[model samples]
Target: MSATTATARPTRNIESLTERAAALLGGTPDDETLRRYLNGLSGVDAVGLEARAADLGTRSIKTTSKVWALDKIVELIDLTTLEGADTPGKVRSLVAKALNPDASDQSCPRVAAVCVYGDMVPIAIEALGSAHGDPDDGGVSVAAVATAFPSGRASLAVKLADTADAVSNGADEIDMVIDRGAFLSGRYGVVFEQITQVKAACVRADGTSASLKVILETGELNTYDNIKRASWLAILAGGDFIKTSTGKVQPAATLPVTLLMLEVVRDWYRATGEKIGVKPAGGIRTSKDAIKHVVTVAETAGEEWLQPHLFRFGASSLLNDVLRQRQKISTGHYTGADYVTID
Candidate 1:
């Protein structure tokens, strides 16, 4: 726990403390009540509580980052449908689908990320470009799903090994699914630990660190407020990026989920001066939808967020439309969606 939190752990009960805080900040506050209120804010995992509280005091919010590569986005859309279940030919076919570099100039992605499951990291890392003489054109560096993906229910040792195995196979980033059962059960420490431990296991061959994006599967969280809280919790607990879903859940990513996360990113950065990333995976399948996300960041979070670091679409289906729109805008001719491929 952060010293701030350790010092602020409530010494008294809520009613008395909140009342006291009101009196101290005075609009007619009470005794120990004030202590409780301050304790509440200070008691959140020290990193999250006090730091976030400090951030809430800022004057204005900065926007998302602006500099990012579209090609990178096109490169990393994890086609999880083919993972583990596919043979080498099927995987190669999917890889072919992934590395296709047709989207160029105005018709390209905003830089795709490499999406492979634990078993496919080596293939994706080794075969992501045309430079290898593969028909595939470009893609982001590899990102492998870890932490017993699709569900974070597992022994910590197993989860850690999964993360290490992916990076050892060449994944540049680790996408870890958080333990929702723990989070929902109010076992915050376990949830925090699962992520931190997974992140710790994501080291490069040279001993550097791979970035971590924690998946909350927002649909199951059930409320914007809880989603926002979870975003804060993940970052405070050591997430490099806060993601919406695992795509395995129904009612996955949504505008509201993205909006709340953006707000938290805005808040977290302001508080800690650390820029956290955001990814909205699952069910976001249209270019217009992708652009709407862009619009939200451009407007709510600021244009600075246009880059791949601060923003990404965890999609297998959206790129086709983005390419179609880019093609339509660049060449002045609208094309059929199939020209780009859907899955």
Candidate 2:
């Protein structure tokens, strides 16, 4: 696609990809169509991905795009470690990091929302201070991954309880994974039910609502069409953010997947006027990659998606790279590893 053509897509400039795909096949697309699309696709047959690419290219309004919503993005960036912090030292380290994210030599996002397993919320709460204590200087507002996470094998009641407990412990966001197996089985309704119920469980410690982000596990879903369909469902089901992967999956997040997601968000925005966020997590260990995602956001969703808001790279190891790059850009030399400290 020509750069000019790519950058020209507005609400009407682009075609409805899913609907187009359905029309291409001469049938309405349902969860089964999504499943079939994910099961196979080659460069020769990937018209959907091609269309999305073309549409993204033509998008203008760069700065006004939703990806630039850093205030929104920063709040949703969930600094997570699903392996669990098994010791007091680890919890203390997490606390210290939350309070002093700059210790990593990279200034943390303005509000480094902590994402711990349900077990660590109390420690995070005390360490950061009631996320509810003050609007400022408090610890991170916790986000807990629920719906059994990664494996996603659990009863509906159990998953709902997991979400409720996370919110009860002061978590501000619910990051839940869709049941990949069920989704793959062409059971989108089940996936929808899962996210809807869990989203309902999100509430603040003060008894308010916590935002919901639905993890698509894109690597496993394996196709742009499927990713788009899943993105639609999550947002329609109340996902505040549509994430790439769990950071547990191989090729966790990729430029291609992120690009597809940006298109999904843009289309979603045009349809509902409700802008949802996009997070590309897993396997992102460098600042350059983060910057590239930033650029993708800039180009795809426009400048509005540039900051942490509509765009975020989920990485335990990426902050340092951003810092290093910033420092390198700021100063003239490679100051070496000695310049930064990690707790």
Candidate 3:
């Protein structure tokens, strides 16, 4: 099947956060306006959401289709390593893996991107060398985690600087954690401004902006309602993607949560004629789990989202399992534990 491209909307034309917020809220971009708009959103039906996700998971794919799904999952993965102990060698190794996930089978598709820390962006770029460009063009992208990733417990100045540093260092994408404290405390305007500012900081010297993925860390949000609200807030504030977690928290990237996020992306596209991406990061560690997500994306958001630009899996170990599955399908036998690399 050919990949479908979604219509691109230029967020840079909006000029300022205030204007962006005003365009969404229909009034001044103040706390009151943000609260009113967000609060007016419909509440989530937890039972219905879970039931739909579960039903989608039970749908089986044919063996021939499974081949396509496995390769597509590989193409959609943001091969990630965000450890504090990550070194230049580790980044280089990861870039190599991203470029060639299965050395034995050159037919294996490359992953979407290699996610790393802000400080490691240059290392990832240097490692990628000629193979780093656009994921849509079969080249791996360098995605950096910034804005006080995971905890997000820092001042706005610090977060903006973090974003700027990453983009300046040649990160093709920025995964930023939102201030959950502010969002939960009803400081919706604060979260909105932060995302918009971070988006601004993503602008590079060449006049192009790095893709900004706003991490909601839904485990901390506590309810499906907040997840839906946060997803909308991220889109309204110019986030290119709404990510589920920073991979440090428990209960990250549940199917129900991902389905809800996809619903939001679908809704946004329906209302605005622009497409937004979704990334379900953390705890997705197997081919079965990855294929389930692929199904959910297809059913809820339409097959157009099957493209790398619209959907992604933020994972590390998930690739090995997928490579194993691919080998099993090709040779009619499962490979040993050493078939895939540990990294």
Candidate 4:
């Protein structure tokens, strides 16, 4: 797609974000404007934030509710395989697993999407076949990690090319990593411009835009305050979803971090009447942990955020554990590992 067309796309306009920022900042979204708005954010009470997250984790649900949570977890998972060794065959297998998480039970819900490297988008789409469609419509979507994923160290041209290629190859969603260096150094405008450009690159041939999930790499940001700032910056840049990490960091998705990100989304929705999705990727490995996140989402962002379009779990192993838990719920006993397909 031409740059003119990409920039002209109303859905990915940078002004949409700047206008919102302007309303909040009382001026255009320049470096000073961003700094003022971001720095003006309320300080996060680390102890209180951690305590609340822990308290939310301790909340429990009934058996019937557990069953529902398990299914919802399965449905919200972005079955991911972002490895150097990933091949077309591996992507196809992942797509198959996403289409049918449980082979024995036809009633088992399919995952929300299959996330792979940008180059593997076609492989996933081909494998998904008829089941490849919008995630909101119960069809599995293909999500590709773009913008030099895991480490946003590339030039702007390369990043935009990476994103454009993925969208042209039929990726329904693009997960992009922000330039943490710029963000950390207080060059918020650079990060904001990059996110807007990447969102523009997500425009497909049909005039529709692929959803953009901006990865904050919260682990690298170092403090709760910075994480909150990055979350707000990402939302202000028109990211459809604000993601926690790339699953390659030391401390991927923590409860406090995810909760903080959800709070950002919650506040943004309340102020603008627009809903933004949140995906807490990495390190979330079990049904129990996923349920805690579910509870956190409900309590922070409300029940409306539980759907695939509104929330997602960027996980691979987490799905297997959820499948086991789901089987136990249906059979009154836990099934062995061999029951679910290994990714």
Considering TM-score, which of the candidate structures 1 and 4 is the better prediction for this target? 4
Candidate 4: where is the Cα deviation over 4 Å? 1-14, 334-343
TM-score of candidate 1 against the unseen true structure = 0.71
All candidates: TM-score: 0.71, 0.73, 0.93, 0.93
True-vs-predicted CA distance for residue 123, candidate 3, Å: 1.2
- Candidate 2 global Cα RMSD: 10.3
Tens-digit per-residue lDDT, 1-343, candidate 4: 2222222213445556767767877886678889999999999999999999999998857766777888999999999999999989888889889988999888989998899998898888778877777666677888899999989999999999999998887788899999999999999989988998898898776677888999999999999999999999888888989999999997999999999999999999898898999999999998888999999999999999999888999998998898887777678552433232211
- Over 4 Å off, model 2: 1-77, 104-111, 130-139, 204-207, 307-309, 334-343
Question: Per-residue lDDT for 1-343 in model 1, tens only?
Answer: 1111111111112244234324434433222332233234422243443344343322231111111222334543444442456555565555565556352553343234546786776665555543221112232445678889888878999899999887776666678998888777666657765665676676554545666889999999875556765786677556778999988898898766676688778876686566787888999887545545665666557767655556777877666655654454456352332223211
Candidate lDDT values, in order: 0.60, 0.61, 0.86, 0.86
**lDDT over C-alpha atoms for residue 237 of model 3:** 88
Candidate 3: residue 269 lDDT (0-100)? 85
Q: Once model 2 is optimally superposed onto the true structure by TM-score, how far is the C-alpha of residue 23 displaced, in angstroms?
A: 20
RMSD of each: 12.2, 10.3, 5.0, 4.8
Model 1 error, position 70 (Å): 8.9
Q: List candidate 1 segments past 4 Å from native.
A: 1-84, 103-110, 129-139, 331-343
**Per-residue CA lDDT of candidate 2, range 177-215, in tens?**
989888777787678667766766764343356667789
